[model samples]
Target: MALDFQRPDPSSPAAVASAQFTVSRRGYREEEVRDFLRQVSVELARLLERERFLESELKALQARGPVDVAAIDEAAVTELLGAEAARVLTSAREAAQAMRDRAAESAEQIVRDASREATRLLEESTLEASRRRSDVSGEAEQELELAKQQGREMIAEVRAYRERVLTDLARRTEEARRDLERLVHERERLLGAFERARHAATDVVGDLNEFDQSLRGTGVTPPLVPPDAPPPPRASRSSDTPIFDANEYAHELGAAHREERTHEVSANDVVAAEVDPTDLGQVDVSVVSGSPATQTPSTDETSPVEPSLVEHTPVESSQIQESSLASEGSQNTEVLPTSDTPEHIAEVVNIFDRQRKREAPRATPIHDAPEHPVFERVEAQPEHEVVAPVTNRVDEIFARLRTSNTERVAKETIKDLVEPEKPAVHESVFRLRDEVVTPAVESMTRALKRQLSDDENAALTHTRAKRTSLTLAAMFSPVEEHTQRYVESIHETITSVAVDAARSLSDSRRADLRSTVARGEVMEAISDMLSSDLLRPLHERIASAIDAASGDRDALATALRSLFQEWKSQRLSIVIADIAHFTYARGLFLGCDGATSVCWVVDPNGPACADAEDNALAGATTPGEHFPTGHQHPLAHAGCRCLVVPLDK
Candidate 1:
């Protein structure tokens, strides 16, 4: 029946081995896979580096343009065209001026021709009158001659007046013509200049259009064209202010001001150093010369740039003085009261004089009193608490405990079992501890210094000895002797308690044993406790006394072996209460050797225990829980700082 392969008890080695395999499979060895992953990571890093290089090359190639070189030459050509347009405008202005001079000469010729025509008409009228007088009879001639003389006188007077009016009219007309001609010349010059500027703009616009076309054909995007960006005006050399195009000046000034203000703090410092603080106070009270009493409207841009100052007159004193002078002037007026009430005015003046005398300053006696300091001293309480004396034994005993344990007793116990402590424990511990730990610590420090010096001979290792002295002193701190004593004391106490428990079990009524056998069993538990890996170091230190008392070597060996085995298998069990409370304070951040200070210790559980250490040793306990599930302690938070003490047998 196939050799009964599935039997509970295997009869052959191969069958037994098959049963073991059936019970549990072997776990995969992850280290080989992890090593493979490392190689993959290196390959990925190399690929990423190559990609970055290619990406940089691509960006550089993308930054270049085929049209940029041509664009620069085009820009220079455009500038030359602009210069030629300016030259043409200058020639046009000169031509306009010549045309204006010719028009003025034509106006002068028109005035001269009108004056010659008037002279000819006057000569013809005189000859016609003479011929008419000769043709008439003698009587008629005499009458005619008298009439002629009267007519001649009237005619000559009329002609003389007409000539004066004509001459005046011609002079006024010529003046008006000259004025109009000058205005026309100015208009022509302005029109020509404007036309020339417009043509220059058109030419520039045409070239820009061609450039835009060229850019598009080359598959290149043209830069954005700014609106109406006029060329900057040339500055006159004599001007103090730098030449700035008003449109761009705001942007320029903003940048300049930012740079200046970055160092503007220095200007204020300079001002403070140079200025007298007292002078500023006086300047506040004083008024500048030429300051107007009343406010006035501001004029154009060339207003004075002087810093304006103001003065505040002492109104009360000025008003009092003004009133006194006015009253004196009024007294004179009262006496000269024209013709009436002169007698009454003199009486009023005498009354006023009596009032002034009553208001005069009075003489006073001075009494000197002793000068005293403004601030009087008041008694203050001391800043630090006064440390009480160490009188109670129980308080002193508990003070030797760590802060974590002392706090637990304080929280658990009712009433004041311990007095308020002085900080004497720390001082006392160091004093006693120094006596024991100083020589050992000093020897260890010297040994470490020698090793460090040997290691530092190589260039790469030299830095390791940089803080050798400080490191040695700190690592071998003699003050920790008290802590060592406390740990040893606790271990010894546990050992004594376990011994008593074993002696009690030996005397119990239920179990049967030979005297030798029973003694062997009790000692076996002790040996197991001592030999166990978890407790071996602490157990050896405490077991030295017990070992000396036991006489038999064979019995002692069995006892120690059994003690460790039993203690590990049955007596030891650790209860992991939550350490949540200790999380808040974290641990003391003291560096042991030359390592960096790990300020806080975070618990391994999670963020709830973020301030706890990864594997903090609270108090050593067994491998299993001591308390039942429902019987957990009050301080069970993950970072509580409370620890379970060993309950040994």
Candidate 2:
């Protein structure tokens, strides 16, 4: 009986060594065949060990749960098994003839069974790994996307908050500018009203002087002219009256009248110096001329004196004589009426007459001058001369004039009248420098510092948000090295599954095949699984995540930079605006160094450093004109290094 050679376990070296093959002319030596079998058995044992591991893994997978049918169909298993069995049988037929043929057939059956089992196991393993890979990739993608979304939201929120701060700063700056304008307008109105009041007061004084001159011309006290004095030549009163020609009067009045006129002119000069020319009316020379009492009267009672003179005639002659006598007795009395009005002279005269009459009764009235009628008619004077009004109560008028004279003299003593308030304004500039400008600059500095601090915090927050997102994305994304390591592990699992399945199928079919050839086949199967299905989709998913993560990181960096720049610019603007508002409100001009780098627009138009130096040396009276927009004030724009200076007119 031919020794029925059962299918020897490929893992057993002893079975291969003891087995007897049918000897034929084509068969090889038993020793050489045994040696080949020994080599095959050794390789088979290695493959079996791998198969056992794969089987155990497959059992573990099956124990966990049911696998999808679509992943492992019987037809696919049969095809894979048949292909592997054919390759193994071909190798067996080439190695040993009939002894190997039987072994090949038995081994072919076993290889087919093993290949089918391995295919099932490999498919199950592949499906489980694919599902796990899908779950991991989905979770990583979701986490990375969530992190990116959170980063975007944080950046947007920071930008919105910065915009709000900038808007509020601009609004506050506008309000400050408006308030400054109102204060300047109010100051101007006050100054104008004060000037108007001053002018009005000056006009009142001039009116009083004119009225006093009119009273003096009433001739309440007559000049003590000797009767023998020849009548003065009839001079053209036209030139004499208007000019108050002391030379014309000297010829008629002798030395005493000239001396009196000189004294009156001196007093008028002193008063005139105190007031502006615009406040005074046309220069009336009649103010300096004495009344007819100081003049040599013409013999004809009806002959008209200058109408300008006659209109100033006194109502009471007796009262004048009495006061003149009383004044002469006490001291060297002035012949000109000192009283501003005719009525005051009359009151003084009445009191003097009572005293004189009581002292010695004038048996014959002291004078020979008759009482001139209040309405005594006089011949008309030249048409060019202005007519003075005929008055019935000259005493009452003179009384009021005396009161005005006293008041007018009193007003001229004030030293500061009509003086410009430049000194006060300069002092106010100093006060503003100390109180407003200094504090404003300090406040602006502090505010900028605070803004810088806030900007830093905002930038830090933005950086942190971006960095955290990036870190999370890197952690969760399959693109990162750690995620790559996880994918590599999955690839290894799939590769191992494929290799084990290929090896198991090969080992079952041909124990005589060389270890290198079997390994090559197993490797080819693993390579196919990696290139075609197992690792390709995973690599693509990781590649896409890497591309997205890279884009998001770049975008976040750009956004953070833009936000920081915007915040910095806005903060600088607020500081500059605050400084400008404070300086302008204090009636100062904002000045710049005129350097090109400070601000191109402001530098060209701004005051030079020398100009500011000159202003500081010379006292300032007025504020400078408003500058054009963009160059309107100190620190008008960001990075401005200008100064606030008092405007020197």
Candidate 3:
């Protein structure tokens, strides 16, 4: 049967001390049992007090937060009872059992409460973590959206800027075209004037030749015919005629007189025509005189003939006609009477001799007559005013054509065309920067950020390695695109350079036909230039960038920055160098400043310099042959900063 024992108050130390236990056969003595019971009761009360204290502390801990129930060792508390409690409490076994049951129940209740509280707190913490994760995800999404929007805005701005640049380029090109037209017109005018002058000079030469032939046919030596004139054809000589034939002599005299009359008519025709300065040396005034007697006067007789002081007076045609008619009438009426005898013939001859003598002094000089109107008009003109109006017109035309301003306009036009192309290259690079590089870098940055947000224990080395590999792999396509774009840009630039070069050559009056560059040749040259100046260098730079970017995040950013900078600065320069190389290979020689700069040191005695000097001397008569070395070809050494300029030729 179970015994119902009244529980003692653990707070009463006296009740615990006075506790008793019933004795039985073969059991301990009553006094000893009672004493053991007292001890057991006291220990039981102490254990109860400890249980209550632990329960209160556990409740306080539960109020604060979730308790670590696993940390609370109940087995340790049981060990604190020791061997004395087990042995002595046996005599009061029922009571002891009751006490132990109560203590275990209290301990189990405390443990159950702590476990429930801990579970509740764990659930709350998980809910909080879930909420925080959701917030972070939303914020990240917003940030990403904002980044995309900014990227779009940036692209729009870039497009607008490009449009502005293109507009400015178009305007400049139009201005250059107009200037080139003006230069062309001026050049054509000069050429036309030169041709006209040449034709006029030829006409004068033909007229002088005809006059010389007339003088030779008339058996009169012309004083004006140069020694270089062809000798007249000689007639075959007959051995039978030892003396002169009278008929031949008379025929020669008659021909001579006819030639004189022809010459007089020709002189009149020439004076009536407009004369250019180019015709001045062609006209022979000495051939106009008809009488050989007047031409071959004795030196003593000529010395005694006083210089005739004749005024340049205008003479009427009617008065000259009347004088000529009166002379003819007087000659007709004074004809000799019929003379069959020698005495009558001598008398008639004497009368004619006196008549000729009287008429010689009365004859007017050729300068005063309508008979020699051409000579009279020529003698009346001032010596200084001999230059024709055509000459002055030619001089003015040439002066307008030969201006330095025209040369400057041509040079500026070429420069504008060539220079605008460089900016196009720049724009292409900038587009690559915005479209390809910027997006790629942004993606990489986001990937890095995502990687950093992973758990601390995450495989950092493996993750970074994988990320770097992926980034580098992805970079290849963009790099290839960039290379292709840059190649195309370079091609366009080179093509423009070729066009500008051709235009310059065409504009240049001194451009040599042998040196004229063809479009096909320029294209071929560009291909050659691509290998050395564009493709190889670009590949090396991109490869180096990839290699550098394979490190930490900082290293990657640095490499990307360097790559962009190289594209902007170095790559554009490479394109320009390629263009220059193309121009050089196409026979468009460029001038260089030989002074020490980034390109090369100018050693006066160097082979290149010597070659340049020799070429300069050889092409001295040809303008734009100044620089020796860099002028002939591209001076594209590694890291060279030399600017190749198109020579004027």
The models' CA-based lDDT, in order, is 0.35, 0.42, 0.42
Evaluate model 1: give its TM-score. 0.14
- lDDT (tens digit, per residue) of candidate 3 on 1-649: 1223553433344444444445444333445434444555676676667657666865885799864657646554345444554344443445556655644654565567667778988988865665455335435655676689999999999999999999999999999997687557655654554455444444433343444344433322212222224445656544331333334334334444456558977976685574464444333222122322223322331122222223234334465456446545554343321233111100001211324433433443563222222122132233464755546878887888888679989998988884211201122212322233233333333332332222111222222345445243344344444344444534544444444443432444223322344424555555545555544664566467557656565554334434433444445444543345344333323222221211112223223544433333332222233345435333333322222222321
Lowest summed lDDT window (length 10), candidate 3? 341-350
The prediction achieving the highest TM-score against the true structure is 3
Q: Better model by TM-score, 1 or 2?
A: 2
Clashes of each: 31, 15, 1
Ranking by lDDT: 3, 2, 1
User: Over the stretch 1-649, how does candidate 1's per-residue lDDT look in tens digits?
Assistant: 1223334222222332333212212222334323433433453455456557656755775577443445647455446335554344444344334434533543454445545656776766654443333223323544566699999999999999999999999999999998787667656654554455445444433443444344323423212111122334654434233322324433433443455556867866686687565443222112112211223323432232222222222224454455446545554342221232111100001111234433533443332211210111112222357999869988776777767697788777856566532111123222322333334334333433332222222211221234432222222223234224323323332233223322332442223222332343323332332234223442442255235525443343333334433433333321101211211111110101122211122222334432122223122222232232221221234224322212221
Model 1 residue 203 distance off true place after TM-score fit, in angstroms: 44
